[model samples]
Target: MSSDVAGIYARESPYLDRYVQVGIAQGRVISLSFPETPDEGAESEHDMLDRIESYLDGVEESFDDVQVALTVPTDQRQVLEAVREIPYGQDSSVAQIARVTPGLDDENDDDLRAIREALTENPAPILIPDHRIRDGPGSTPPAVVDKLRSIEGL
Candidate 1:
């Protein structure tokens, strides 16, 4: 993808009680965060923001159509893709993800650690739905994960 950032958008989120910021590059979300304060002059017209609002409103919105730009190793990308397949309102364990991840031995300690590392390094939280992973929030803050889980009723 291009190194140029197309735009950065932010909007107040009711669920998190903070502003949700999204970074877009080449029509795909490159990053997501909950900043204490919204960036000055940041636009708030992206469709992703609209969908996020709908999701926070208790709607079972699907983020599958929302494209994301993840810059990580092949293994981590595979794990993140597997996590995306998890249905909304449901959760999965690390072992389950490792089992589904190709070339990863679920019973092996190193493989499991790799899975955990991938999760902990997840750059996009809500967009990738890391909170859907049971007992694993990756790098997402505990409060954000808890709020997201509450929103999904999990």
Candidate 2:
């Protein structure tokens, strides 16, 4: 896909690798190569960027308008508080929920309540890959199905 805007999301973990996607206001959409597992020794930002660049080597998408975004998987969200690079945000989108309520399923009701309260900050530019939005709401909003099954859940 050829578009002025491209976005990426990368993570380093056995459970979470990386994801890339490109989008335009109203044009072609591109989902760049997503490595199931990041290359060995890819423990730095530069290394991850190189890995991402290499992944996009053959893609025809426009990097000129590329807007890179990052997603710290639900498993890694809470730990991000110790890291200064990560930003926080609020909205009802799947990504936001995942970040704030990371592993919500495993979290106790009190933990979820705390997260709900912390979201008052409402961070902006909720960085997320374009493909995530395109991947549709199922995987992104995994709870939607269950929520829909019961109106009270919503």
Superposed on all Cα atoms, the candidates' RMSDs to the truth, in angstroms, are 3.1, 15.6
Candidate 2 contains a number of clashing pairs equal to: 0
- Once fitted onto the true fold, the runs of candidate 2 whose alpha carbons sit more than 4 angstroms away are 1-107, 128-154
Residue-level lDDT of model 1, residues 21-81, one tens digit each, is 8898888888888887988888877778887889888899768987889999999999999
> Model 2 clash pairs?
none
Error of 2 at 48 (Å): 21
Error of 2 at 126 (Å): 3.0
> Quick one: RMSD of model 1?
3.1
CA error at residue 153 for candidate 2, angstroms: 21
Decoy 1 TM-score against native? 0.91
Give per-model TM-scores: 0.91, 0.19
What C-alpha lDDT, on a 0 to 100 scale, does residue 103 get in candidate 2? 55
Worst 10-residue lDDT window, candidate 1: 1-10
Clashes of each: 0, 0
